[model samples]
Target: MMSRVAGLFRPKEAPVVEQEILSEKTAADKEANVISHSQNDNSSPSADKSPDTKWETEEILSDVQAGIQDVEALAKVWTRWSLIVAYITIWFIYFVDAMQQGMSTTLTPYVTSAFKSHSLTAATSIFSNLIGGLFKLPLAKVLDIWGRPQGFTAMMVCLTIGLAMMAACNNVETYAAGQVFYWVGYNGISYTISVFIADTSALKNRALMLAFAASPYIITVWISGPLADAFYHGPGFRWGFGSFAIITPAICTPLLALFYFNYRKARQMGLIPERKSDRTFLQSLKHYVIEFDAVGLLLITGGLALFLLPFSLYAQQPLGWKSPMLIAFFVVGGLLIMAFAGYEKFVAPKTFIPYELLMDRTVLGACVLAGVLFVSFYIWDSYFSSFLQVVNGLDITKSSYIMNIYSLGSCFWSIIVGVLIRTTGRFKWLALYFGVPVTILGVGLMAHFRQPDVNIGYIVMCQIFIAVAGGTLVICEQMAVMAATTHQYIAVVLAIESMFSNVGGAIGSTVAAAIWNGVFPKKLADHLPVELQGNVTSIVASLETQLSYPLGSATRVAIQKAYGDAQRIMIIASTVIQVLSIISVVAWRDIKVKDFKQVKGLVV
Candidate 1:
């Protein structure tokens, strides 16, 4: 029994008559093994047993290596082509986005008039700004998990639906809801494009690629205002919203399809591992919920909304700052934020805002600088178009055009700065050397020359200076943040950067509203003669009412003067904020841009 068991475990051998043949075969097999193993020493031992085995193993190995090489080659081809397509698609999307934003800006007065409320304008602006910023957190996660094509598709769909809702809405509340959806989608798309660009381009060429992708903003900046004016005057505000609903989807479909094709091809070629979630539906859902950190998202969104809404609501509240609702919002919002901090620090499995990034001085400084810069910008920007039309006696088209000089400057200088950074691989010095003084000079000049009688030339030049400063700082700050962080943190850091900027914009809009609403009406009443005093309410209600008076009439002049005084206060405040922004620059550390290589082959 023992002998039989041992025999069962032993290998079978050929008979003695076949030994010579087997030796001949073994010799041939050995030769083949040597040739195959010379190319790849990692071959399995079973491959050397016979000629047939050797040929089969060698053939399998060659096929696999070739397949891997083919996959790698195909990945390169897809990456190269997809990058070019993505850039072009992003440029077009940006142009449309600019046009949409311009339409919103120009149509604000009309939307308010139709709704018969000026406060609604401020409220919608604040809501959209806040919501857009908050959405970035979840959107970032979505891009990481579901991939860019899905995220892009979601944004495009949201935008289209939002536009449709706006066009068909009959009430201010509905209109406001539509704006919320549209802005969230718009901001998400912008963020996604930025991340895509970062993923595709090398660190050395990133800034230039970003600038090139953003180049459409320059053309749209100059043309959007005029286009918006025509649409509003001819086809009406509904068309302004509805037209994009039709056009944007048409443009996005092909691009999305291209992305899907590339992504599928990559997976098929084994360039990317297959995403496997071998769980029940409910389990998968739970897994995603935890992965996305849904609790953290809700906490932050609730906190920011409650905290920021009061700024717009305070003016509408009869008791102003004394309102119980305002007090509750602040108190509750503060508690939620504290809770969020606690959760992220201890309870949450995954933190949305990485604590490690906060510890990095350069990243933190860039975020702070962005926040401050936007705060300064929006303090004046929130009410600038209305100010130009109502106070400075400029037409809607001309005012929009003039306001976009800032954008024009931003677009032009971004490209120039991008080229310079690519060449020098130096961004910190550029940010400090040029960004600070130019911004201060621009804001200071604006404060001094904000009067109705100031030359248009001087106003444009001041705007250009401020815009160029903004463009330069934006690029440099982005570069600084990228250099300071590792690949895994880049998307989150960028999201944080955008979040701070948008939050600052919301705060600035609120502050501007508080100042404008609190002081402008009172000042207009005081400046107007007794006969025109009753028109203060009307003048404040609509820019048209303010502009209806004869060009040089006393009523018009009073409105202009009142607006000028109020605007001066805002501009001066912005100048102070800009100075603070410059001071924030000191915290940034000089990191070599080229020494770091951004990780390649990220799908998003």
Candidate 2:
């Protein structure tokens, strides 16, 4: 019985050991199973695990959605007032340009009368302006580096001084020098502003801005022409020109202030990231100077100077085509121009112009088209007032009012075309489909213009037609050119186009003047009776002298026929050039418009 009791006590210890072993075994088994399950889950696909794993991707998608919404909201905040300000700034600058440009028409007669030479007027107007054109490329580079405000401010100051000089000048030399300063100052500042506007505006809205920019030239014509005439005759003639000294500074102050404020805003908003330059200021200046093509500048400027000098001098003194100086200017100037072309092509390290643009097919085409259009523009503008005064016997103010009709047609149609371009993403097809034929028809109609014999209503209609057609063509041309190149090359392309257009204008003016001079005098002498011929010549010599032709009679008939013939010939010739321009338009390479990225602090 004692042995049995001891066994039972030992058995209790064994039971306890068995219980502990079972628990330990279970714990080990559970840990192994968890590890194995985790490996399998990681290796294989499963629905329950996916949501937890994709959380990061879902978060990214939400962020992107929010970003897009923010962008859209920001775009909505960009108001029309910004664009309005830009338009007004451009208008102010171009209005000044108009005063200078039209000042020539009024000033020319006074200049010639003062100098006692008819040729001096043409020489001073054309050559001094050409010198200004020559300065444009360098000024553009300066604008790019120093920014528009400083460049424009400096130029305006120079221009104001130039005008003051012109107003006070007592001699022809001082007057001519003043013209040079005026041209250099005006062209450098105003032309750069045009480029600056191009840089700022989106492609879609550029035409509208440009139209507004071009508007002041037209709008000012209505006011300035009459104002110039009125003032030239008025007691305040000297004061009228001098007043610009004060007015220019007043106009510039607001623009400069805005420029500074905009620049500060751009910095705060991080619009353009700052670039670090290794060179010192002096080094940078040296680099810019060394890189500028001095030889190209010299040849090009000299060529223009030589070529224009004779043309400007021709109408004033020793009025013969075959004068030794004239022959030398034509020959030497032509040779120098060819040399400049060669230098630009083969030798220059930093070209004054981008010569490769000349070789590019699309750029070349646009240039030709712009040249023809501008040629027509200058011809009508330069001669039209004289035409109205002499042939129509209308006063300057009335003729200017009539010219407003042309401006109205242009302004209206250009806005329409700009809207069309923005909507369509197309340029040439519309012009080809609607514009070319219309322009030709307009030119043809204008060619038939005569004196009182031609219907005044028809003449006005013709002006409207030319303006509409020409406006559309120019807008299309601008769009095509802008589309062809990137921002880096736009300025040089513009400069080249301007250079060629100036050449075209010079040639057209010279040729037209020559033809008119030949036809008018000979016809006046031949048609009138022997007794009346001397009187007619005397009146021709003194264009200011009051001379009346019989109403609806033989002498008036002959004069009208002569005027009609001269105008028709010039118009027909201009039309033929324009037809060639249309052919040039066919070669433009097409570009798809891309939307501009919204810059954070852009004013417009």
Candidate 3:
């Protein structure tokens, strides 16, 4: 076995005719030539060789081929069982994610009440968004360098720590810190899973696998809200978060073990190349510093955080847009962002994002589409449940049920689109031609029908339509981006795509906050009777009190109308954003999903 393994790397010998020619030379010359040829052969093997060497080479090649065939057979068997395990793990992750989202949505009012601050919910959301965006690039680099198992382990550790912190928190600040950690972990894990799925599945099955992985969200959407509501009303909201902290690691252990096992097998089989570094400790530190591009991460994260900070702050601040701090944040953040662009373009030895990806029409279009669609969705969604409670007068459970129709539609259509893509091996035009128009129509209807007197059925229909469009776009855009790039860059590119989407959500939520804060209070004061004007601040601060006014009373009607007007503006903004998304879809090239070929390349 040892001899056969060594033989695989042994050089072939010269042909018989070449040996005869060498025999014709002077004995001393032939000896010198043989020495020179052996030296050359050590550096570069020759294809032309002697009969004995040829036989030896063939035997070694045959042995290596047989080994490869055996490894392939073992790999197939492992992949079949492991993929099932992986899918199960992904489903649990999605379920937990959905539960978190549901709890966050339903428990916002309670959390804010606990903090005795109206702005706490929005503040936490902005902070979470920042964390999610900030950590994605670093996580991408970690996955690239350390491989998936380590990356996944790191993410799980962060998540567990974050959840524990949240469960133990007594103050809003601590809770906010917990959220930061949780979101960072969540974003890392989510992005890693996407790349993992891409790595494990074939191109033909990737869409279906991703869609199937997401199916848990659909089920969780219905159950999580009620579960959270039960927690809120029974054992308390802390338990809602605490239970998951313990449950997540338990569910994730097997998945992590599977990843470790597969990695070990692959490494042993020589399928994975070993990374060699001979630098000193300090030198190694510097090498990694440049490799991870830490400065680029700081600049972009700081820039984005600063730029987006003011948008959320302006509405909450006493001075509003006139605040000096807001202006400074905006200006400095803008400059840092520009500096980051310049650094990437000319200064960085290795760029954090490859310029080639930016130039790819499909990738660019997918990012824009995802960004714009998120902006559109969030514009209306940021304050949607509040509207349902205040204006529509629905209870927490009912409003949650109504809101989750969107998730239901999203999950259902995502699966359908995935199957269609798998069957037809096409997605770009489906998103462009069908998804864009449907999304436009949904947002348009939402804008037109957001009045207080609008039928609940119409609202539900609009949610379903928008959700379906969102689902279609999500699957298609992901497929387009993945298909356009080689596997090496997939994780980072996906991170970049996620960054755009999260940034869009932050901006949209901020904009919605600005619009709502700017318009709602003034509208409420204007519409309310003179006697009730003094209480506008208190009323707007607490949505519960806003809904406490007697049904069918003049005050109730005025408050409802005010909410309707504000929501209409938000819906219109969403409509405009969706229209922009539709226009951007024109840039997407119709890359065939089936034709995607994984190329060998270094991670940038």
Candidate 4:
């Protein structure tokens, strides 16, 4: 196994055009020139650039760099063994994190079921996913300019608070808040780590490294299920959520220790620069406001929530689609989104997205691909575990393991794709020729097997089939975004990719909620196989009620059939949208990793 894994990550030179072969010195010179040009562009902006603005921007940059940027530079003096240890350290960090995530995933559906609002699961998910996605925009600037320590600190705090909130919550509103808080915090940490990987690794090694970093999923899937099962059945999910509040912060110690060690080393070597605050309170405020594009973030978040929430929720309105409340949501959301676009394109000093990257074909294509992939997944995935337990009569442990087949399979398969990528130094053809075909087959299979009376084994087969392509598409799209720019914009690039992915999840959640609520209730009346029916509203309201009857009993069978009917439509919709991802893949520039260092070479 080790030998095979070694072969997969053994990096090789990519084919290069003769004239494009850059000498080592020339490459260094080009990098230096690019840095210089960027510095000059900022230092000497248009005449409209204010004195206060210039001072605050540079001062903030210096302060942030002085605090943490030296840690990366300190690597120049590190031993090879130390670097290996650092890699192992982060891997362990993710291991602990995966345990927390596993516990949370297992508990989520029950939290809603406890409230008898299991069907409203996707409704809460819309906000959680929306906030999680929108939060990345500001975080990119924060991590990019403000450094990792602060980001990590914020992440730890949010996580601790969020977990505690979920643990002690008295009602669904608080549970929903817990869900939102937890997702936001998780997204922040994920963005930080991805940017760190991008910052430290070579482009050719990126997909391989990402897949390896994600390898904990293989083990975690097996363990997380039992841990969650033990907790849920033993002390209940409240205790499970509460345990992580303390455990996660404790697990984070080693990662922070590494940062501190690097910091002290840099300080000892005189690598740390001394700087002081030059901007006054207001000036500092304005500088950060513009840098983070706080206004734009607000507009987009409000816009997306207002606009998209209506689609999912319109069925709840008295008049359905014609409800005035729904109409207002649509209008307000559309206007805010439009206003956000205008702000970014014309009014804002620094656009919410970095202007140059926003224009890059690879970046744009990555955004679309990421968005579509997530949309397709979340549309049906929001209730999959619920489906397993309620429909198939699988235990939580069994259901959790079944769900993670996608993650476990993706982890291994992505490594192979990474190998192919590392060898050939290109990914477009892999995405087009392999990822697209498998996704179509998998999703098509899903639409077929996700019906009443179909064998449970066939559904598992569909997951494996989808997992075959899932890993490849995920790696390819992310690498496409990363390949477009230098480390300077790595965090922002990741933010862009994640933003799209999260937004897509939000869109998917909305659509899923619409289907589950709108279709399942309506179908309950028509799809019963027998006359042995119960309270329609009661069954629709809670999965617990749906499962109250014996497995083969009429109400239970009818509810399962109704879920099957709803899920079929959801999966078919997912299948239809997934084809759009092929267009995004085809639109990507097929740049080899060897040529990636040429700035703005995204067009190929």
TM-scores of all candidate predictions against the true structure:
0.85, 0.76, 0.83, 0.87
- Write model 4 residue lDDT over 381-484, tens digit each, in one string: 88888889888898888999989999889988998998899889898988999998898898889888977788999999989988979999999988988877
How well is each residue in 1-604 modelled by candidate 2, as lDDT tens digits? 2342132221221210000011243666444221111111122223343322322122111222222222222222323444345456666767766665565455554554454443243345455556666666666555555556667777887788778878887767777787778877776666666666565555655666567667665567677667867777784456666777677667767666766665655456443345577999999877777565767888887887787566545533465767887889989998899999998788877888765667667678877877776565554444455456556766767766666666657766887887777677677776676777777777677777645466667767877787788778777777766666545445556666666665555555554655555555566667666766666644444334312564455665556555566677667777777787777778876643333221211222
Instruction: Give candidate 2's error at residue 300 in angstroms.
Output: 1.6
Per-residue CA lDDT of model 1 for 354-400, tens digit only, reads 76776678888888888888888888887788877775667778998
lDDT for each candidate structure: 0.72, 0.60, 0.71, 0.76
Model 3: pairs clashing at backbone N, Cα or C within 3 Å: 13-49, 13-50, 14-49, 14-50, 15-49
Q: Which stretches of candidate 2 lie over 4 Å from their true place?
A: 1-86, 95-107, 110-124, 169-180, 187-189, 216-221, 264-289, 308-319, 532-542, 546-562, 594-604
Q: In terms of TM-score, which candidate is strongest?
A: 4
Model 4 CA deviation exceeding 4 Å by range: 1-72, 528-534, 595-604
Residue 520 lDDT (model 2):
56
Residue-pair clashes per prediction, in order, are 0, 3, 5, 0
By TM-score, how accurate is candidate 4?
0.87
Q: Residue 83 in candidate 2 has what lDDT?
A: 38
Rank candidates by TM-score, best first: 4, 1, 3, 2
Q: In model 2, what lDDT does residue 318 have?
A: 63
